[model samples]
Target: MGKQVVAESARRRRRPTKQGTVLTEAHIVETALRVLREHGSAGLTARRLGAALGADPSTLYRYFAGMDELTLAIGEELIGRALSGWLPGGDWREGLRELGLRIHGAYLAHPQAAVLTASRVSGRPREIEADEAILGVLRTAGFPDRAAVRIYHAFIDQTLAFAALDAASLALGRRARESDEERWESTYAKLPADSHPHIAATAGLLSARMKDSAYPAALDMLLHSAATQLAAARAADRGASGTSAR
Candidate 1:
């Protein structure tokens, strides 16, 4: 006991003090989240987080095993934000639509973090809740359990994929966007009046809707398609089961 005490004392004397030992995983994660929002994935390093926290970078290791673990925590935080204030009451359609929009909005709000965590598969806290919420809505809306689960899968897959896709698109340089825009304006907008009547008619509407309004509209359309597909599959299942019994 005396030897252990001396060793502890010597270690304490040699060890440099961190900015604050009261620091915790939550604080680290919250700090990292802010860094991610402001500086993006490349900026979210243990060194950077520690520098922001006024501590040695190694101080982060005391809370997290490594960068991957910290990133998983960050991912959970993002998903938790998506699930916040998300009441699943009332119409199931409204519930699913709101859930999707909330998740998409949460990711879009933190595009860097969204891109970092979107490709990772971590079944953390908010991930489970989001799944339960979507599955419950699909099931209650008359989808068979299996079909409900499938639709839930598609719903989340679409949310993350589209969020990342848009973030990536926005991150591309203005030159790329300008060139793409010029191409569209020159080629599509210049379509002959009768050759591409639909494009000519709705090009203005498309241009207007592309200014962020298209996201929610696209999500609504996706949800509607999934719901319709689920309903048809459910009916076919019932019909098959009845025929077998007969």
Candidate 2:
């Protein structure tokens, strides 16, 4: 009991001293982001974070209720960083593509955090801002509210999903990428007519296109289809509303 008391006293001293100091939430979130980038998800314990700032792990509790809250803060910070300097005054396709690229870049920048937070929607202020920004752009391009929301959902989901996949792909290093490509080519070469007839014939194109060469074109086609469908839906709604108003 005496030893336990002594250890507790030492821990108290290790904690931050300013019980009443104004600890900005942004600062805590930013620190968490740095910790994630430097150490990955496995290294971001509250104790380590506090020690990095010369504070006790309890100091983090003053800002966040728990680790889940801290994860939310970091997620919003990542989204907000992607949205920095983004303005909605251009072709809708260009705007949306730029937004997706920025998001992908941000996720790649802190892959450890991205791997952890990409699966959940935080719905925090920064996340709301990102959604609004995308929806606002789509609306200004003549999409109705419902169509705007639909396109917005698809756009955001694809970007996050692709970002997560792309980040995981990159962590494999150059050797893994080449080795995987070679192995794929080997199996594709062995595809017989009895198994995958069509695949065997175009195995060369299929293999090449299945890798990096096809993603950009496929992404563009998807975006084009989404934009066209959204536009048609908006026009239909407008026509219906006009007839009803008459």
Residue 147, candidate 1: how far off, in angstroms?
0.7
For residue 201, model 2's alpha carbon misses the true position, in angstroms, by 3.8
For model 2, residues 4-52, the per-residue Cα lDDT tens digits are: 2123233333333444333456766777888876777888999888866
lDDT (tens digit, per residue) of candidate 1 on 1-246: 111212322333233335544566677788887897677788888788888877888766656667887888777888899898888878888888888888888877777777888877778877777777788888878887887777788788888888887766554545885676565566777788798899989777655555443567777887888768877887898999999999
Residue-pair clashes per candidate: 0, 2
Any idea how many clashes model 1 has?
A: 0
Against the unseen true structure, what C-alpha lDDT does each candidate score? 0.75, 0.76
Question: Whose TM-score is greatest here?
Answer: 1
Tell me how candidate 1 scores on lDDT: 0.75
